[model samples]
Target chain A: MTDALKPGATIGILGGGQLGRMLSVAASRLGFKTHIFDPGANPPAGQVADQVTTAGYEDSAALLAFANAVDVVTYEFENIPTAALDIIESHGPIRPSREALRISQDRLTEKTFLQSLDLHIAPFADITDAASLEAALAEIGTPAILKTRRFGYDGKGQARIMSPDQADEALNAMAGAPSVLEGFVNFSHEVSVIAARGITGEVACYDPGENVHRDGILHTTTVPARLSASQRMDAVLLAAKVLNALDYVGVLGVELFVTPQGLVVNEIAPRVHNSGHWTQNGCAVDQFEQHIRAVAGWPLGDGQRHSDVVMENLIGDDMDRLPELAKERDCALHLYGKAEAKPGRKMAHVNRITRPQK
Target chain B: MTDALKPGATIGILGGGQLGRMLSVAASRLGFKTHIFDPGANPPAGQVADQVTTAGYEDSAALLAFANAVDVVTYEFENIPTAALDIIESHGPIRPSREALRISQDRLTEKTFLQSLDLHIAPFADITDAASLEAALAEIGTPAILKTRRFGYDGKGQARIMSPDQADEALNAMAGAPSVLEGFVNFSHEVSVIAARGITGEVACYDPGENVHRDGILHTTTVPARLSASQRMDAVLLAAKVLNALDYVGVLGVELFVTPQGLVVNEIAPRVHNSGHWTQNGCAVDQFEQHIRAVAGWPLGDGQRHSDVVMENLIGDDMDRLPELAKERDCALHLYGKAEAKPGRKMAHVNRITRPQK
Candidate 1:
């Protein structure tokens, strides 16, 4: 096994969005330089990262250079091409491992992996073709969601079906890509556990946060989630189980649905989750730092929340509220340096301290 | 007055030390890009800043180009050359104003300015020559400090005159430079208030943090300092007084001595100060962001302490403790991306939460 990375080591991060941007900032705080690799130009991460390679993941030459320049590799997104991972892994260790990525990249694989651990999850069926899609629909019944098995995020590559009559239209929307149909969860509320595991197999979890979504986009995450003590314990334990099962060496974001029966796993992000953004103001060591510490093989930090925080995302035109939000007492405004405020884009966020209430 | 800067505006920062590094990170969080200018190559600020101009402040062309590229200019140090400021000011506004820099750069001018405002300060006199030094020493008495009026910081360019017999040697230590002889204040302890003034003239101050110096270097700053409620109010009000006196448009660090006679102003920094580092873990909005917000003409944030914190600087060999310190609970580590841990150099710091104990 490789030795723990010392300060001044370069951390190569794949995908250069807000998560990558935040991770870059956290790495710098720990005295580690970050090199960002993304196909997009002027990525948010590039604004703060030490280096930026604006080349597609398919560019093996660029990927090789990135991996070789940094002591270790980590990613902000899970949908990186397996081919790119293969080239990068040959040069350095990739935190969370290739196995975690392989499973998380496909809905079918992710669900099956969770089931293998005997964890509770929504009932799902893999949709390879129209015949199978219809057959799976018959078993799953109505009010289910059709999702692309791969490359689906933020409600993209998804369609909702309320009745059997809509199955063909939903299937057509998939455009012949592999898909998964999940029975709609009867959840009272959604919560996420931001958990991390160090390279030495040590795990830590932040308090679960209750999340609210608008138009399939995360709107806000409030700490002190509406969960009983036992429920909170269950969430953290299950999250730890997943990390250990995957032998993950970085942060994993586990989303769950609170139901009458029990908490059901909805999805998992193999990186810092949006729901945990509240930790930036509420905890001593935030999720980004925890991820950096774990990836660098350093000891995990205290994940305890010091105050009640409500993290609200500034989406697109939500940036309009910034002038007023900037004046709000006990509010910590964190804006991603995105040039344009496009619709549904996460432009910024405000972590408002609700405890020691004013 | 210039209108408030919108998100995505570039902020030009002079100096690229740890303070600049932190300012860059804070500016990025507010969706403002920072361009760091420093004579040193590969400065700590460059690790996270959007851009770095590794050119001397004497390079007027480079300074002008830098100033014209950003919406506003601020600094991490007060010792910037006046000629450079003249060139930069022609292109963009400099927050905290040039007057603040001019006054704070010179000890005599700073003390005189404070005295004019009816603020209590140590008795001081200007010494342009040995004869004047002797005269000032006689008036200020023994046990006074001889300091260079300009370009002195962190115990540099200072000599103590403990007795009349040592006057000649102390004067020689000045090396023919302009100097100031100030009678030291007999105080209980030193504390600093990190205060900010927005362009619109609004003011906000973080709670005073008790300071301790080791060999004239800052050792620790603990917030919720050992002060009565009245002393805290006095500190905040005096800090605000300094900001308003200068019509300051950014964060200022005000060092004060709590004496039996009341609070006596020691020094005022026109930018974020080391004593204010505790705010990073103690308050919702840190000094860096407060400085950024003020410079950007945004509204000030709540500076109230949510958690008590003790910030300790990890100077040089202190880095050896990072391994164990990283494992400490409720500790937030901030390391500057400095390549070498040279003796007396600040490599990193740890803000440990001490309140709501353990």
Candidate 2:
């Protein structure tokens, strides 16, 4: 609490994609230089950063140099290995703590953490073996989602059970590894809260964003979601509770399933989330800046929305709408300079602003 | 029109400061690199650009080398030396054509240009030596501002006249250079329109910003300015008129005086401006990116406000608010990474968002 991040201090970032690219922009805006360490030779974040280290995550020598160069360390994506965390944590401080990642990375552990908080969660059970898979499927019933315990995103490494007979197929598909069976909930909508907790334990949460996903990829996020006041409050409280519980010191996104009863925790991202992209044009300080502030030992920014916004992710050929989108009276378009707009690729995004009558 | 600007294209910035620094950031964002040809090294824009050429405005060799390296050149300021532009035009296409700069670079010429378009302007007269100054003073009269014909900003290089004797001092203070004696129209408020004209002659304007200045330095700009519907339309149309007149292919700021009669043209900046800082948070495509797109022969973006915003310039001691500003809910603070915040120096700015209530 006694230390304030000084200008010229370098922030070391793990993972180098568009999120990292934007985080570097935010870090530099606050007079903090960023050093990016990504195994990829040409990570997007490296383009505008002060320096970049293109070495393997397991290369302890390069990791040490990166940690030594930066005053603080953080990551854009949560999938970084535990060994990579250990290597960096042994040197500079890593915000959002490893405990947070350890919990969020595992479906069973994440569900358990949510249940302990007396929060609503998707009905789920751990499946360690074929027998347990059958029992869990019998209990949760058909049309249940069977997901690997770790390393899953964008619909990867996961399968769904439409009937009891499909349980064996799903478990065998995971190659007999640990899994989680989630009972499908007839939720009304999907929403997410992107919040941050500072080093001093101050927490701030942005308003919930209504998210729509297509083909397991986020398609759009509209802010000031059409949620009841109670639902919004519950979502913010859940995000803050997660941050405080984990002793997190950076921005995190809590995805929630909104049902007729209330909000249920889906998953937590211990980093900036794509759903918060609307903040780039709708809020005062964007989620990227908020993350930078929290990890830099600076105060968390006010996470208030200034305008009703709709952020649409430009996947693949959706990028062709740049001209069409930009011509929309108040639409904001952002195109990441990815070489190819292959199918299912996240090439860019568009944010459309509308005035909510006061 | 089908050709997109390539990397290594020269972006000819007229003024070397933080706006240029941030503009350089936007240029690199799209993979189109910039070569800043500011007269000095270590300019804020120079810090992040691919290359910087240091030379006087009159140096043809340096200008030619800079122009030859890039496909097209775009300026960051309007008052570029005519001699310098002469050389650059010989080597590369200068977007926002030099005609735009010529009209904007001087107060008298700008007023005349606007008048030619049937646009309203502050009543003004040109002054060269003592006799003309006396007659021009009588026409424009006392209680008006006496501004140098060239090189003025943030209240510098100008003098105020209140009486007959003060006129002599004001004239002498300008070092006997040509000047513009303008009648100070008592106005209720001031604002600016930041807009872009694409290569195809399309125009897009961001919402006008109500501007306030202190000690000649811009202090704050609030979006969705307190102007009548007619005034807003007039301001935007006037800006488009200026852009069309120049065949301008870049972003420009047109400052206006909201007098009792109507919105009158005040001044024009042939590049990104301090008053339009709100775009960084309030709009999807910031003024900088719009400038990049226009100069690159790309379609112009939607220059619309996503939220009501107040942009306050962090000048000198004001920069110390970084800590609190960061913590303040819903305030997006942007700092220029300046090593020192010297008096009258622009260190950064903060945009506070005020979203319309649903």
Candidate 3:
């Protein structure tokens, strides 16, 4: 099969959440089977995957067995334990590579990498303790966010420092873990570019999507983001630079703050992003399939959008509106088969095709 | 759960071929799990389904277990054994009902049913024996088709008679099985209406797609088929009439011959058809998802096409061209993870978006 996996090759996915579920579906579309490895029983992706390994990442034996069972391993999320990744890597390749994971897994490492690339990023300082926190606060300013340097997502393990007086409380939120204090970027809006790099060093980027967040979770993403022609070009160029620098394969999500000065790199995820969900309906080749193609060594697909779409995440009680959403015209519902829709949990999403833009 | 199966409910599907595979994926998008029951081991749909029951229809025990496990049962093919259906129905409800299956399972019955609805159909007569075949030949005339009343598809189980002298050969091709002799329609082209009827009896139809066949197998289907506005209306209305007549639930494919006089009903499928594959790329809610929604008792999604698409089947050695197709711009490839691609076996399909039509 060479580097490009033939149809029927099994892809091992690390997380069995909505992203993995959709990835499994996309892999199936390309004639590839998927095996999901997640700790949770009957995870969302497990419902569609050909096989499931219901073992935690800490289980070395299970991890080894999982890696041995599939052609290659990929993940829907970062933050994988280093030992687990070592075992999998020893057995088979991991798409997006371990360097991309190591960099994005830590805030300090991520911001440093982006800064080294000469990309615009928010002012940031590393904080180790109360002394360092005070010093960093003095340098970065008071109106900033104090975030744990690792394992923070969806506003978790972070606290906002609205004023100098709130420094102590904000620092306490880090709970003695290594943290980074980031000065807030005064931007008009947030936008994201979902990009992919193939094994052969080719890069493709979807158009930037204007994102709106509520409670630090993605609420909606509308394509044809309010970007100037140059900013759109800059976004794709920056994404390509990052992909080349990392020698990355598979999809990456770049979140940027659109400021008057330029686009600021807010963060980067080494896998499929929530904001890219619009591509499921707006493009012939979506992000999930593109990621699979890249990882499997297939040629990169065209990522141009054909429809203008507004993708709204269905959170918690949003399931209550499903009756109406299902009947809405030109609205496509993608529901994660979660047994319970906990508050703030993404239960589903709906992509409303506004019109054919291309 | 009422008539409408909730998210996480299981949908039991018969015939785990490509249609079932796509249906399972669509069911997952709607937050439903699928259980595929097929006699073949490791069927394509099983690769993506939540569960699989690999037992033949004759196995009453497996049938009972399968029916009991699912909230509702639907099928990819209509030729389900009656005894198997009886067992499933005894345990739970089957969408599209037994009536639709009964009517479409045999050519004679299907033609008779279509004629009863006052729809235009090619002259057809039942042939139970050589005497009956001779009588039907006298009525229907030469340049006819002698087809088995049961188990015929993709030009199989039928023989073409270009002259009266070929009648005996054509009749012999039936091998003493009940048959139907039908006079060929002088049509410009063939088109199909992929329509769905919800549990509440609301009907929705996708724009008719023009079909081209090779070796009696569907070669391609292009949306926005060459039909006048009135012809389009007639096609949709005829499909709606069939759905209403059968009190059908789930998607149905109605093939029509576009004759100079009017649209002639060639045949109808009780489930999703190959000619409707274009909807996957052309419509917001495709035929597979529409079928899942109907069987699950959800509202019928809007079936309007948003993009101009041409879907071509990858048959047998056509799989060799996958590398080129994968690199083709605006093309979406859907491969069935079949182990072997024998001659005439549908290996996959590629939908090429020509342009945004709507």
Model 3 pairs whose backbones collide: none
State chain A's TM-score for model 2.
0.97
lDDT of 3 by residue, A1-358 (tens): 2579999899999999999999999999999999999999989999999999999999999999999999999999999999999999999999989999999999999999999999999999998888887888788886899999999998899999988788889888788889999998999999999999999999999999999999989999999899999999999999999999999999999999999999999999999999999999999899999999999999988798889999999999989998889889999999999999899999999999988967
Q: lDDT per residue, candidate 2, A1-358, as tens digits? A: 2497886678888987888878888887887777889888767676567678999988989998999888999998887888988989999798878898888889889999989988888899988888888888778788899999998899887998898888778888888668898989889899999999988988988888999999999999988887998888888888888888888899999899888888888898889999998887777678998899899898877776667788989888876665555466667665554566799998777777776433
| lDDT (C-alpha, whole model) for all candidates | 0.91, 0.81, 0.94
lDDT of 2 by residue, B121-161 (tens): 87888888788878987887778888997888888878988
Q: Lowest lDDT 10-mer window, candidate 3 chain A?
A: A1-10
- List runs of model 3 lying over 4 Å from the truth: none
Q: How close is chain A of candidate 3 to the true chain A, as a TM-score?
A: 0.99
Of 1 and 2, the candidate ahead on lDDT is 1
Misplaced by over 4 Å in model 1 are A356-358, B356-358
Stretches off by above 4 angstroms in model 2 are A123-141, A164-168, A175-178, B1-16, B25-42, B46-71, B81-87, B111-145, B164-168, B176-188, B223-230, B258-264, B301-303, B354-358
lDDT, candidate 3, B56-130, per-residue tens = 999999999999999999999989999999999998899989999999999998999999999999999988887
